[model samples]
Target: MHLISQLCFLLCAAALGNAVVLRPRDPVKYQLKTPPLDTPWTDKVGRSPWPQYPRPQLRRDVWNSLNGIWTYQAAAGAGDVEKSPPLLPYAEEVLIPSCIEGGISGLQKWGVTHMWFGTYFEIPQEWNSNERILLNFEAVDYEATVFVNNVRLGRNTGGYFRFTFDITDQVKRGQLNSLKVFVFDPTDDQSIPQGKQTKRLSHIFYTPCSGIWQTVWLESVPKNHITSVDISGGMDGQLNITVHSNTRQPTQVKVEIHGLESEYATQRWGFESDQLAKISVPGVKLWSPDSPKLYNITVKMGDDLVQTYTGFRTIKSEVVNGVRRPILNGKFLFQFGPLDQGYWPDGIHLPPTHEAMVWDLELIKGLGMNMVRKHIKIEPDLFYEACDRLGLLVIQDMVSMRVHTNARPSDAEQAEFERQLEIMVNEHKSYPSIVTWVIYNEGWGQRTDYFPEFKIVDRIRVLDPSRLIDAVTGWEDHGTGDFLDNHHYADPQCGTPYYSRLSSPYDQSRIGFQGEFGGLGHRPEDKHLWPVEGAVRTINETYEIHANTDSYNWRAHVLLDLLKQQIERYACSGAVYTQTTDVEGEVNGLVTYDRRFVRVDTQQWRTDIQALYSAAAGRA
Candidate 1:
């Protein structure tokens, strides 16, 4: 009976054209390429690289993940791309969410700029009943024009921020719907916030991600649904929430706040579109790296419901003794962590799985670090969620772009840059873990510092006055912002000055910070190294040591002493290590790129960090 039923199902599927069965699992047909080093989660990446819910802050229960094998084709040239959709089903296949350049994508077509990605999805009957069905893309590099059922939906321009489109009119209910996307990324060829992506991959810069590199999904929302929620926590116990809706009419919103650990009375408020609502919670525990407490919030208007979480904490700068310090919740605590370059050996710009991202955070926590300088790249919401849940303070950096060599951006370019910056702040402002925003890194894409009227830093301050602003992390200093930052990659032997000239009294209003230091390089076994043609081991004047347990311990000890000196002697409030993992040819990370092993002894590292924290506490 079982065999007969299976036979009947296959016959029926054949009768219906077998769209689900003939979804193309044969990799040879597509001629895909795999990376040399595979992460542990690489094989587990079956179809979807990150199948989890894309939006954690604004989440609905019923959603469909449009991730899996997708039809892929590299355009013949720029002229090959046209207004209409690409030819129906391409012979090549690429995995969604993973860029076409990365190994996890199954198509390691690196240099192709123009490409077409097509997939088919079914709109559930229940989803069709909703007033609106939305299609969302977590991120697409450079430029993207989307099409649903061959009908042009819209286009998005940013590579690091998420965008959505209403596909209610395009999708067919209870039937397979066609989705096509065209992406063009001119990494170094254009003046954009390309981060470390470059046409030439060498030194600090690594691989370039071209197409869809994050999650893609479909959501069912009401016509008058809640669009956004801006939650801000104050030191005075007041929780300010501004609930935004699509409808202009005033609507009754029920806000339910539940403490994950502590008991708190639920508060209610009536929400109007674009109006601010305030509520004070009694005995609110301030969120810190030590005790990161989050409150689950549910916002419901009419039939629209969305769930989100936020932590209440206050961040400010105050003079402790003679030196200014970043104070959190009216207390002084030194921040120290690695500069996290969110890159993977297999996935390049993205981690292979959600668990992989969480693993990196957990490793940082276990190493006794309190903060992470997310260097020059914006991660997905899942990264921020893990940081909030695990109590890791984040220093987010706006992606940098040097339009011209050490030159100012034209007026038109500056406007677009500010637009992207505003989107970055508005999208991630609700996350309590983000304490500082680094505006310019190593003078990338920065105008002449002499021009006080440039006012990019001022613009950011206007957008978000809650978090501290870092005008410049290294090299060129505008003599503004809350941190007098410097990037000093001292010699591994401590032969060079640990601090730079930025520590002078010229900026009395800013706190001293070692934005980057200690690029101690150590290449692991050949298996862990990223395989690239003519890939030279670009080790700085750091250290040359064996990859043994004892050497790794010594390296960790030396690093601790170096950071301790910065805190005690220079009164530096924070310091960021060169990086978390090695990228491409750079082998100066605490961990290998594949994430299979940690070079340092976790237990010893944690013990040393704990001692450092104790000393810092006494100083505070």
Candidate 2:
């Protein structure tokens, strides 16, 4: 088998004349002058930066990861003028995927609003046989312009989502190819989905991150190939698969499902164009927080072969006894977990490594939590994959825009917001773990007059009907969406009553959820701290909990007591705690920012959290 694999690699290399040049590892070196909050994976980042394949769902064997040292220079203006060509002996070297503000990127300067990144890559000669060579960017903040061999490909706006371009015509066949990318992020200036990023970092908002913050890569695909595949599991032991292709010719989609007990069961379906293909599994294994069972699937269409996986599960808001409870796979499972901000101490928006991302999810699962509200930030696809595999529910929030004025947004801004919302749903709709989509969080950029919150909910429902929708979390209950979500802090006694008074009449159809609550700030022990430059000395100072307060004990006790109170008094179906981990100045996390310490007693916290399941089940 090893010999056969070697022979196959040799043949592929031979077919691609630039065998040695097309190596995965880049020769350029980068050293972080000032490391920021170093994790176990931080040191290994130089050689193998996010070595894992960027796209997990659509896996292809032949692809190159363009995530290593890249030549970078801080440019003037908002990238309005083309200062230089794609050719470069750049001013400085920075790590790809990590933004300039991050210490791991080597250029930790914050003033850089516009920058140029240049790198050279060798395209395998064999890849030329394919009609198109795709250059993919997992994410680039604000706006990004791509130049292939000094020839402009295109520009992509919106920082959070992924974008791709075809560079087949501009690339050199076997020689090294030059790739240049110019990025401009007007953090708070533009009404984009900036999440919680701001120039003046204080309170909830953290330091602004500019340029590319996710993986960049290249892939070669045939003229007629599978573009994307949307997979959703059914309650009736059937899988609904939609194969979207860029081909005009008739193609046959071959699907092979592999499970623990079931062997590779093959099925074929013929389609003239992009079509829906259904494959039934007699006894499908349902995925849950207890048992995360994923069915590996291999899809083949002509020369294109893609590897993917999907878990069988269904989510709905059903009345259990009198209260509307969230039903996961025919069970009224009260989703209780932390509001995960998805911010990393080392990499900010991006994780130090794939393992680091998985570790956070593992901790969430270990804490006996079944769900996580991904608070106001869109994470990489891998984050959702980890949740799916670990059997944790995710309430994916749409990155919010910075609303400065009371006036309604311009038409252009509203259009852009809708476009991003559509893209978010389309890109991540397949993830079974994403049980609910939280459209608006505490009315951050919500305007009911021009762009009604209800309209956005309607649009999201049209795009993805499989998952539940929280139209507006916290304050404004627009009388839309599947849940009446609210945010509260520390004192559950006063908070629950305030929530009740603010709440509209009970709608039996829609469930009630405390989307954000229990922000009991706890400062980690001194030894586990990796304090940033402007970070607060203690969380108590921010939350005004008094300097002498035993914060750790208070935080833990408050969380436990609130969890019980919310379940019993409010009769709430679900709740999301303030956060999973500390972020910058905001030290109200269950764990520290460096991920070195858990402030609360994990064994006891787990037991307390698990008690909610029993409590909720008894209510049903």
Candidate 3:
């Protein structure tokens, strides 16, 4: 009977032009003239390029992932691009979501600032009956102009934020649809916040990437569907939810909150357009790094249903033992982890696969670190999701650009930065793991004027008051924001004058943190290393290591002891270790550049970290 049913289903699918059997074509492999260090996920890129659902926070089952291969061409200028119409054939094929400068993209040739991408996809007949067809781009670097079926959809600027266009009228039903994208990126131009990207790669600065560096997809929704849902946790143990709809119709919004282990509560409320639905979970389990509890949320309104999840916890600054420290869930707990710069040797800005991303966070957990400072670059949404599930706290940094000496941005550039800041907060506010936001790092792309820093801090606080803000991470403390962050390097035991500088008077209300410290270098003999021009230590200089185990033990002991001392001597609330893994030329990481070797013993590190957490909690 099962075989008969399967046969009938196959017959029905065949009758509908075999559309059910049709799937996205396998991505083509691009042979780069110069290859990068091979990772576990490198070979999988051509077969399945980030096959997971792009958006995990607000999920819909009825959507198509527009990832895989697409036709690509490089244009010299706008005039040269104007020579061809929309949906024009391309000279070569490049993998979507991988930048042209990377080995995975097939076209590793750099120096071309302007480029075009084109692809053809057939819309599922079932999705053609919706009132709105939205074409969503998870992210596109710098600037982008999109076209569908030879009709110009829209233009978007800002490389970090996501954007969407309503292409319901532009697409044809039951036919193949055409998509064209034009991208322009002026990396390190000083006007834009290009993060750590630079045209010329060097000691600190890395290679520049352009065009669609993230996922692109299409979804169908009702005319009066929910556009967005914002969730936050209150100290009073209540969940605050605001649902925004596209249409101004009165509708019933049902919210069901389910604990990961058990069912919690279900409630229905009348929502009109944009309405705030505050539901109280009487016995909610507060989320923490050790006990990361999450509640699955299901929202239903008429025919529109969306799924999401949130954690119940609170973060604030309070006086503990005569020193201002970060209080999570009304308790003083010291946060310690690595300054995670999300970059891959093979994928560059993009991770090779979802598993590789999860592996990084899992390693952090295995090492017993409770928090991670995501330095400079804003990662894809999947990264935040992994943090939430794995119980790791995140301090997200706004990507900085043009970090030259005394850099300043124009008024328009400042406005663009602020706009992207708001989008970043709104999009990822639901995640319970993100407890803080780092606005600027070491005065990169920051104006010397006080008003600009004041405005940025005020805007971030206004957007989401639940999370703490580090207005500036390293130098030039504005005396604003929630934390006075500092960066110290080399051996902490040397006891340089920098320790005395940490005693400088600052805001009494804010907490203190060593934003970056402990860059002890160690490189394996077989590891791939980028050429460094300057005089720097290639091996462990502070401690003599006769063997590999000695290297790992000495590095871990010195760093962990320094953190314990920092907390006791300076009343420091938190500290981010220099990095999680080695990158290109930088060999100061707990793990190797290719993630093949972890210097520290996982069991011993976890035991040491637990002792630090206990001390900060006032239990020891």
Taking all chains together, the TM-score of candidate 2 against the true structure is: 0.90
TM-score head-to-head 1 vs 3, winner: 1
User: Candidate 3: worst 10 consecutive residues by lDDT?
Assistant: 491-500
Colliding residue pairs in candidate 2: none
CA error at residue 306 for candidate 1, angstroms: 0.6
Q: Candidate 2: minimum summed lDDT over ten consecutive residues — where? A: 18-27
Model 3 residue runs over 4 Å out of place are 1-34, 79-87, 248-251, 260-270, 491-507, 530-549
lDDT for model 2 = 0.76
Q: Write the per-residue lDDT of candidate 2 for residues 248-272, one digit (tens) a residue.
A: 4557777777763535254444543
Off by over 4 Å in 2: 1-29, 79-86, 126-131, 248-250, 263-273, 404-408, 493-508, 525-534, 537-541, 544-551
- Model 3 sits at a Cα RMSD from the real structure of 6.5
- Kindly indicate the candidate among 1 and 3 with the higher lDDT: 1
Pairs of colliding residues, candidate 3 = none
* Between candidates 2 and 3, the TM-score winner: 2
Report lDDT (Cα) of residue 166, candidate 1. 87
Top candidate, metric lDDT: 1
Q: What TM-score, computed on C-alpha atoms, does each candidate reach?
A: 0.91, 0.90, 0.89
Kindly report the root-mean-square deviation of model 2 from the true structure over all alpha carbons: 6.3
